[model samples]
Target: MTYKGNQTTWDKLSPSLQQKIDTDLSGIRQTVTNNKTEVTEHLAKIATTENLGHIKPDGKTIKVDPATGIASAVASTSYYVEARQTAGTTTYDVNIPDVTAYKPGLTILLKLLENNKQGAASLNINGMGVKSFIFQTYAAAVQNAGELQGGRVYQLVYDGLYFTVIGVQWVSSYEGGTDLANNPYILPSYGAVGKVDAKVAALQTQVDSKSTKDVYTINIPLISGWQGLAQITREDNNMLTLYLDIYGGTRTGGTKIGTIPAGYRPVQTYSMYFGVVTTASGSVSPQGAVISIYGSGDIYITSSNIQHNIFIASSFK
Candidate 1:
């Protein structure tokens, strides 16, 4: 709500003796009005929040930050060992088997090639970027009764982006199921590997959504009263002409009344400042004509860069 600056706070009171005190206070309201208007207008011009990332396109990409989370390189190839028994469990020192054979408990190297290049480096597994797991060495072996366990189960986590498994080619093999002399496993036995997506990938999608909402609220205050007389204007003293153009007849081009450039700058359109205003019950002239504001581009963001002019009712007529 607004008020005419002709009456002062004290003058509004009912007087019994021709005003308890004599004073010229009519202009007092003008000062108060101007003060209040300036404050509100100033508050509107403030930048609440902004998506600092939007200013730069590269900011959208996620880079490994060593200062925060753990940053490590993805493995080109990782291997694990698994042991089994055909007869009784024997305590034997085993090593990684060659890539030519297939034997239970034999360490097989899983090569996670990026962009088909074994030396290619990436941040996550699949196309979605999320660093939850990395390729590492694992060992599995079968144990004797009460000695340890039955058979060792090794787990290999190949977590990286852009690298999909084609097939596991056997490198080599070793001693067969048991201690038999004739039992011998060969090499080059290949197997199929399935691809799996990481959970961190899904979590990143959620984070982006929340970030967008936060950015929206931050720029709201910067665009307050966007369509009113507080809008940016040019020319030293053309208030009357500008006012007439905006609400004047269906005039077009530079001849229109409110023909000021939409942005705070003298020229050029900052996608953020280019928009049309929809008014419902607010008038530029005589009385009530509702005005609803809408933006075409990133108006809120652009509005923050412009200077706004707020005039109290007394400043005019």
Candidate 2:
């Protein structure tokens, strides 16, 4: 049967075309009316589109265009932070000098001071003072102690403390290292740093042991219960790996502070379910016929060159 737009008995259009037209128009209208509803429906598989998917796009948000009156472009980058180091040589003292000794652009150099020296070796700069900082080595003369050859240099400039270690390297470096060897530990730097409260706090259930790398599970009420999730085994040194299994599915992303000497945030990945229900006359592609579904986006969240943190959170229902 056919139904025309005469608002009565214009039986000229096929039912399938009518349905598809109805769906596409309805989507455009709904986007005009309410965004939250549209976003939820799109995410929940209630609504469908050709190339649309559930993706928190990089820098571009699923926002409405004020002038065009449709959901169009949105800001991309959100927050930033630098990943910290896990271990460093405790050869120098890390303490904050008096404010009088502080000067902008003046490089502050100091050591993280590792009391328990072992492994690749690194000092912890957690509770050190800010300002009064200097650099030295246990055995060799190291210039740019803030950055060294044996390891990395974690310098808390404002606090005047620093650590000489290389626990965290760039992800690209990790890939290169993997080409030579199959070790994920030689993977790269991870996580983020900076003053607290920079990004949105996604407080998860207080973990009992923060060092466990087994197949753990996280129960999120949003997803209805505890789902089997994989433990973050191959995380960057910054501790910025969030691995989760929700609704019998798995999603990997996270932002955490650790002992690495750099910072980074997880980039957003996209996945969408789309299809056409029926075909139109003279058209091969039908309505509700799924065309393509996948996820893709850039890796880095920003182009600051200066390192930053990787903050991430996810919910599935």
Candidate 3:
């Protein structure tokens, strides 16, 4: 039996063979129909004058400019790229599909990973022509040790001629000891540097207290960063023993030096002299006398005798 165009010798074929041919042709017809639809869709897409992304041979989507006929691989809107380290220095290589196709005002996001070293990292944008980018740590120029640490994310914008970093997320963990006090590039938000300033400010306080008959007491406010330095001076009074207590203690001897109290033995004591003065008894009194003490926690001052004016100067760190 001879086969003709679009017609097989069906009458001469066996029933089983004819059934097989029918099933095969049915599958071919369905395949052709599906292919036709796909071709039509592709042709329609090509004919449209709009900027549509097309799949490239490499399975990447390439954006096509309808008016300019320029094509470029579409960059990710928000992407994360890690930095590589060589010889203790971190670096990155940003490869753009087409530099010319990257329009101004376009932004890209990158998350950079760094090593525990004290050196500057670099980002090289290949094929960027004369364009350049400056990366910063905490809004300051990234130079010297500890500026570029692990876990940093930055947002870069292309401004037609160059790329500029517009945003940053700096991790608090610093390598190379680049703290707020040491590294000028590290801002208060980066590490514990902000607390250092508060600690320094809380180091000193001045207060005035008076003792009337036997003992005098003054309340020293509690400070978080208090270190403990107390300078106490007697403004007026006769020659008598002065007892100091940070917590609270009883005085025993008339000329006994102050004690740190039963529960406050950790407080350190220091003796300071003010000057000599004449007592009401017509005798040359002890020179201007002052006592300096250092410790932590609350301060409580006690002295002997009434009408004794006392000035207390304290510090912390």
Candidate of highest TM-score: 3
Winner on lDDT (1 vs 2): 2
Tens digit of per-residue lDDT, candidate 1, span 1-317: 22344457546756742242333344576788899997886555443332111222432323333421232222123454433321221322234433223212222323321112112122221222321211232122211232122243333333222222222122223323454345466322222111113356667777877743231101121222233332332333322111211221222212211222333232223221222332333322222222212222122221221122322221110
Off by over 4 Å in 1: 1-17, 20-27, 50-118, 125-317
Local distance difference test scores for all models: 0.29, 0.32, 0.46
- Residue 221 of model 2 has an lDDT of 25
In angstroms, the error of model 3 at 265 is 39
lDDT of 3 by residue, 241-262 (tens): 2333232222211222233333
Per-residue lDDT over 1-317 for candidate 2, one digit per residue giving the tens place of the 0 to 100 score? 32346855435667887787778878887787798766765555422332333336442334323432222223211111232233353233333333233323223332333233332323222243222222332322233332333333344322223322223222211222234256645533333222123343422233444555433232222222223442222242323343333233112222111211112222333322223322324333332211111122122112111122222333211
For every candidate in turn, the CA RMSD to the true structure comes to: 53.9, 49.0, 18.5
What's the lDDT of the predicted structure labeled candidate 1?
A: 0.29
Candidates in order, TM-scores: namely 0.15, 0.14, 0.28
